[model samples]
Target: MVPTYLERFGDSVKFELKVSLPQNTLPKNTVYELIPSFRYGSQVYAFDKKLGFSSDSIGPYVSPQTKASFSMPYRDGMEKGRLMAYGQLTHQKTGKSLKTGEEVLAEGIITTSELSQIGQYYIDESIPVMGLSVKYGDQDAYGMYKDGWTELQRLFMAYSNLGFAEKSEYMKVIEGRGDFSHKNLLFMELKDYDKVRKDVLPRFDRLAAVSMATTEKSEMEIALLSRQIRKGEISAALLNEAELAAAVDLEPGLGEKEVLLKRMCEVHPSAFSFNNLGVVYLNLANRSLDRTEKNRLLASASEAFDQSNGFFENPYAAYNIGLVYWMMGDKASAYNAFYRAMAITRLDELRKVHEAALGAVSIYNGDYRLAVIHLNKAEKNEINLFNQGLANLLAEDYYNALIQFEESAILDISNGYPFYGMALIAARNGEEIILYENLSKAVSRSAYLRKRAPLDMEFIRYHDKVGFKDAIR
Candidate 1:
């Protein structure tokens, strides 16, 4: 049987059954009869077609083989059903029954196609929490801080260029704050300055509201948004860039979002905009099929991510750059980017963990034991668990690999990679039947594995086996 299990395509469940008769099984005047049927629960449905063979159908010395195919209408009850074939030997002349036997051809039906239209979606929820801190520091060991030196320099220049009308009072307040240490600088709220001095400059208005402070800080070090202003008007370019970025954040289609984000960059380039642009390009590249177009998009994505990394050191851009470099076939660069991503810290814990796993895998190269340690840090989701299983399998820890694979399969029943991992372990252990069983389940859930099984070197020993070929088919 080509699929030792049934598979449903569209509205039909289809399968093939192969029956072989030994030489001389059918007497010269006798006919061997075969009947096929499906059984689900208490219901039994027989196939409309019947198969029969006689001595005249086979040559004198050779065994006879035949293949029967069925495309049965799929029903909900048949999901857990079995196909059975019954054999009978009868006298051809009088049609008298002589011997009878029954066997199960295939067990159960895989209806993974039923879940084809399923998709993932998320609900928007608002949560009140502390936002980015006002503190600026150059000791960005984890790459979390923005460029404090650049902002501080701009702040000093802004104060240096202030007009004489309000310069004296502003200087008085600034001088009263003591030394403005670069490492412990703070960006003071313009509203707070308005309380201290009545005639505060209108140019000092903040583009965004400052979140309520949850901790008290020393007033010795302060910076202001007035650094961004010029000639009595707020920075219109910055305002335009912010509006465009907000539109981009609304997540238009990739093409539209790419255009808007590029415009935002042209208006006022920033790490955030470049990183998001890289993500859009990466997505476009992934969805494109033409090799030339895909290469072009990947190159652009790589460039955008590199620009983002140059502007600001962050894990998202590093991880994205790794992905783009990986797709570009630059394995060394990809490994370096992954390493950087692993070293960087971010508020998004899961993304950081995923990047760490990728980094550890790349850093260790083929040292899968160390990779498993890093992968274990990830949450026990299907992808993470499957990766853990793969790492263990490569490390030659078949016992743990099997456990992880099983756990992954249990978590996501429709996922084929876990079963495929189990199949690999079975092949390593020389368990041919177990390999076929798991491989069958794997191919049932994944069309890619169905095409890959025959060509995969892991199954080389079974390449010539009929069962392996049938399973792959």
Candidate 2:
């Protein structure tokens, strides 16, 4: 009879060998010899000790019970190989040996190569594998050989057997000759076009036919692909493709300023975007160099600001509109915008606007004392120090402006504007030693300030002084 063998536990195997004796035969000292062997790949091993049995029974009685066990050593790269056990039983009494059918117990095949590749891939992607079983199958076979084989098969199916499902998912995000419009819409919303195009799209294209034929598609796989795409580390072509899938709707003959503002409002309706749209319009108006374009851009800017106010209560929006009105020489509207901004948020920034407004009103109404009072109050706020100094200079309060500029420079030494203002004050006061020091510092801080000094109101008088231009140069 053949040996009945079974794997009893992890790293150990159990087998029960049964041998038959001749009928009506008996020996005073009947001895049975048993040898066990196992083969794996090109390597084979025999148990070091021979299994021995002796019995006095006759007439087909079972021989003395004997059990044998052999340990299987852990081997790398042996997962794909098969293990077999073979043995023979011999009777010592008559020197007869019977080759009990070579019991060949086949072990499950292990895909070590595939498992190593997957492990390396996970490492490259910075994924942690702690606590998770490395082998295939459930927790019951966590460290068992069968579990490892099972895991290998599962991974193989994902990469090969279900290739078609993966390909369809990839094409859905890349807009490549497929109905990927809805996927593209989702991609655009998630800002994940680039990743889908670079990684998923290309990988699928390479294995397109295989993926299309796959039958084991899974929602988890699709979700994982989407997450990887949104990480934004992928290519820009993917983003462009997604954008193409979700094409923008545009109207004919729309002004550039109008179009930009409308798109900003529709695509990004945040307070920051609205305020930025207003600034864009204001910039275009300033650079138009044509009265018609300037009026058009300013009108567009005003409309954007109005739209911004509806979405967000921001002081900067009102303040920016006021600046546009002031540029258009509309004093009443400019003042109204400025006052509205100031009321919305009592930001010290509005004090500078109020100072400028009061200075203009005082000069027009011939109320210098009121203008000085407003400017003095504005000068007290750290936010308005720069503008306050400039206002004092305009009011011909040169000494006071110098003091204010000096204080402002001390507060923010990196501000080249204040440094240049200090240089101007020093030169105007004929403090040549201080002038040289301040100008040198200003030039060191900013090359632009040094180059523009010659064209400045305060520095123009001393532009030709010896070594002054050379120092700036």
Candidate 3:
């Protein structure tokens, strides 16, 4: 027997068995039957029988050795088992059979193939936004209120993987970047706010009332809370108490924005107004703690997006609907919405949205080839590159997946997902030290991944190893 141990690849465990039969070891009139099996505890799994050479059968034998190979589907509890072979010799003339003792062949198995990750389609939540022309640092060009602009900026920066402290620190950096001075002059260009104040506001007193109702936040508390909500560290309902009350004190004006947008929709249900309203509900859902409340908000947002789409073929509205569906775990509906967005526009800037959704959805569907094709078409980024690596991993292309993960790590060192992907590759290759190194680095960077490592089956073989436990801790 070669290797003395078996290795598992994907769902199967395979090994080679070489048997040597010395010349004249068996009588010419005798025949041999060999049975290969795996034994664990009291259970035995047997393979198909193979017949050995017999001179009486008129078979020409050049060599006195028999080389055979076996592959069987892997099962649980087989990891701690041993391989065994049994033989029987039958006399041709006398019709007598002699049973041979069980022979231990090799010990198995190394189950490192369980580390491959299942890929999923995700709506690129970062790209979709409310309002028309609400580009970063250029919210004024779209006639959005300053409070709404601030909320939108925070919404874009929110990351579920980040902790509250990290999120708050990033928010400070954003506020310090520039004092929104350049955007102010651009804001004045919005149909000449001077004209809106003297002509429109005076004509419609209700518009003045709505403008007064717009809430302002001196601090970006909702940004921190949004990160917590996304992380599941805290829920929107819990923030109502005094201890964390400051976080949702003003509700980040999401409520106010909803009220104002609803009033605006009653008077003028334009595509832009309805789309912005949908955006408001989406944010509200992000902050919601209760599953039912979140689902309701997502449904409301989807309906608003549908209304926006009916008024005009708005790509943003389509993309937003896709995001809502994704959050709601409706993969089929999300794919359709994302596909619709791509159909509405082929602009290179929006390629990320289309490629990511389509590729990830393909992965979720177990179509690795299609997922790779879509991912390959997308521009490189931490998110898409990581998904590309995941797609390749699922396709059993470890080499390409490792390359993609390495590239993704280079793009964003702080991102734990790329490191986690590399750790999975290391585990699959049975590189224990490398696995521990990468796993340690990964879990150290993201609290989310730290919690996932112990439960992940990829490292099941090393669960008892000290290095594995320490790395996850």
Clashing pairs in 1: none
Tens digit per residue, CA lDDT, model 1, 116-162: 10011001112111111112121232122222124333343465444
By lDDT rank, best first, the candidates go 3, 1, 2
Positional deviation of 456 in candidate 1, in angstroms? Answer: 0.7
lDDT of 2 by residue, 1-473 (tens): 34332222212333444434454433445555556555556776565755554554443554344455445543433333344444444556567766555555544322111101101111122232111111111122111111112232233244432355554454343322111222334444543446545544445434422321121324454333333333434432322211211211121112432443344345435343455566667766655679998998888778767665554444556667776775575545665765566554333444455554544433322233454665565535322354456546545577777787778687868655555566666776787667767787767776556655554435545668875766576
Per-residue CA lDDT of model 3 for 207-300, tens digit only, reads 3224322223334665565446535576544332221223333345777557545644554444556777788898778767799999999889
Candidate 3, residue 163: lDDT: 56
Q: The CA-based lDDT of model 3 is what?
A: 0.63
| Backbone clash count for every predicted candidate, in the order shown | 0, 5, 2
Task: Please name the candidate that would achieve the greatest lDDT relative to the true structure.
Answer: 3
Ten consecutive residues with minimal summed lDDT in candidate 3? 133-142
Q: Is candidate 1 or 2 superior in TM-score?
A: 1
- Candidate 2, which segments miss by more than 4 Å at Cα? 1-276, 283-297, 308-316, 326-336, 343-372, 375-383, 443-448
Clashes of 3: 2
Q: Would you estimate the TM-scores of all the predictions? A: 0.51, 0.36, 0.51
lDDT of 1: 0.59
lDDT values for all models: 0.59, 0.46, 0.63
